[model samples]
Target: MVAYRSKVVERIELPARERRERALEEAGYNVFELPSEDVYIDLLTDSGTGAMSDAQWAALMRGDESYAGSRSFDELESAVAEVMGFSRVVPTHQGRGAENVLYGALLSDGDVVPNNTHFDTTRAHVANQGADPVDCPVAGARDPTADGEFKGNFSLERAREVVDDVGAERVPLVIQTITNNSAAGQPVSVENTRQVREFADRIDATFVIDACRFAENAAFVRRREDEFADYAIDEIAREQLRHADAVVMSGKKDGLANAGGFVATDDADLFERCKQRAILYEGFPTYGGMSGRDVAAMAVGLREAVEEGYVTDRLEEIQAFADLLEDAGVPVYTPPGGHAVYLDAGAALPHLDAADFPGQALVCELYREGGVRGVELGSFAFPDTDRPELVRLAVPRRTYHGEHFEHVADTAAAVLEKRESVSGLEVVSEPANPELRHFTAALAPLSD
Candidate 1:
């Protein structure tokens, strides 16, 4: 395939290490609190940070700004229908909005929701509703270095056990996140989804999908699943969604849009309920929480994201970065997932124990050493859980080129060279609200 060429039109100057360290200290050692100008390569997340294509920008100008039933909504609805095989599309400002409305409508006190692995926000939303969120990832998923092809697969046996233990009545729904973000962005097999759907049906529970990276997941399915090798990406995506009762999507990731999300379903009753909640919390059913321009960009991005050439190119870019890190002897999660490369902070900084938050430590060191910002996906992000300490470098869609990744790889290598000197961190101040504490938690380097 021929490569598509694009030119850069904007540039920003980054601050020096001393300036960045002062900013980091003022921000209380939270990478999230640092200003963009202070950082060099920002990889905090792929969410809402991708660069829009020329066509997407053009579509934004053609946005139809109507209070209800806007033309842009029509296009978005049509795109969602065609790409996801869903009949309804209730737009939102971002993925969590979709989750908020969907879970709010379905969950009640004592309800239990199971997933392969719940991303931080998803887990928080479920917990907020007085519902228990359980993770039933496949056994291989726990091992970061495992070469399992479908590490994101849900454990069917565990799912059945949960359903039996909690009783079907107490179980509101079973969610499966495509390209499981919390589990190193691993892809779930098409066969796995079918099996989970059957299990959900047997237990009389709803099976919804957290399809933030559906396109990228589809690309993996086409390459990894023998039966799907002959199928187009859109067809593979539709087949995957066919097993789900509904889909909650963050258009920010796969939709290639800067900001937009939606809850899609073919079930008329669920659609109606979600639509009502969307209106109450988000906006009118058509526009939800997004503007007309965002909707238009998302509609175009939804289509562009699933193209065979584009998916291949994007995956290659991500893998190249991961390969670079691995070559430098960094302990990276292998069989690289669709979106991000996860560095094993525990192994990278063996001197720091889990209690010291090695992941958070690595995140700080990367910024202090190279002005590169990344998010910690380990204990700092989930204090109650025993999840491994990891620093995630999520690649934004079409945002950076090969040169940028090379720079990141070099920065990471530089940090590793002085890994022994990198100290651990302890909480200086934590939010009163325990939920999602990593976003606002303050920390300080431990004394030698």
Candidate 2:
């Protein structure tokens, strides 16, 4: 396959084996704390890690640095409206900032927000608002072995169960995360989105979309859903988002920018409330928590993210990464996903239990073996939540090539060969907020 875009000016050199070991020890076995200089392949996250396109870089110069009524804000608002079908836009620093700003306006104490699967930050933001975040991903998502195409789909039955238990009046929001990050970056179907929309309407709750990877999810919908087989990627994206009343998006993901996010809605009342919150927590509504240049770049990225060529290349790259891992006898979550390849840490390290943190152990082993940094999506991330133990190798858009992923596969295979020798991790120190502990938790080998 030909390169869609190519320019590699910066170069990186991996730290020595001893340096990598020392770095791991210094970080207390937490990959998140490891300095980038010591890591070879940094898969810690896709957020703010993607390479910006030339067009986006050029858009930076068009930024209006005004404190209010900036031209850059107009560009972003227009992009959000044209691509996501939202009428109002509230800028934020990042995705969690958007979640915080929007949820503060929408959720009250004891309110329930049902989602396909809430990622770490989303869950934390909801909890911080004194509301409950209930995950209702399809059954297929729970089983790492399942090969379903739309495993990220919100389970209407499960969500209904939550509503039935909590009463519809207590359910204020129904959020659907595109390419559900917590569920192995699986894609949610348009049919599922429609079903969720109907459910939200029946319950008189606002339907929201956590649209970090909206374009990726739409690409999957176009490939898997018969009804959308003929639709363009952008059309599919708009169709999926159309079912939602509002959206909280992290521009870092699908937007292909390093920073920036937005909360968009069609409801005037809700939009006004979110804007108020943004003004209080973030900066002025025009710039929010970002600079004008960042907003402008994000505007360009939002449009580029929906292009069919870019979406196809990204999906293919992730698929190839998953394939490479599987061929190397690494246990992986099936059907692949949009942004990352999830390793079934429990399956790979069957000797360890959930309490032992197999996912964290796999993360540590991968880094120690090859200076590769990935994150645990299991007990460490969710803490007491009964979910699959998986390690996520999130690929940054336009950052790496086939060779990098090939090296990752080889590293994972090496870890698997020594799987039994890999000791489980025990948390030595964690944050007060259990939901956000994974971000800064310190761990140690169980054997120690």
Models 1 onward score TM values of 0.98, 0.98
Alpha carbon lDDT at 143, candidate 1: 82
Error of 2 at 328 (Å): 0.7
lDDT of candidate 2 over 1-448, digit per residue (tens) = 5346676556777778889889999999999899888889999999999889888888898889999999999999999989888889999999889998998888988988999998898899899989999999888898999879899999999998998898999998999999899999999999888999999999999999999999999999989999999998889988889899999999999988999999998889999999999999998999999999999999999999998888888999999899999999999999889999999999999999999999999999899999899999999899778899999999988999888899899999999998878898798998899999988989998875
TM-score of candidate 1 against the unseen true structure: 0.98
Per-residue lDDT of model 1, residues 349-408, tens digit only? 998899999999999988887788999999889888878888999998887877788888
Give the residue spans of candidate 2 off by over 4 A.
none
Every model: Cα RMSD to truth: 1.2, 1.0
The lDDT, on a scale of 0 to 1, for candidate 1 is 0.90
Poorly placed runs, candidate 1 (over 4 Å):
none
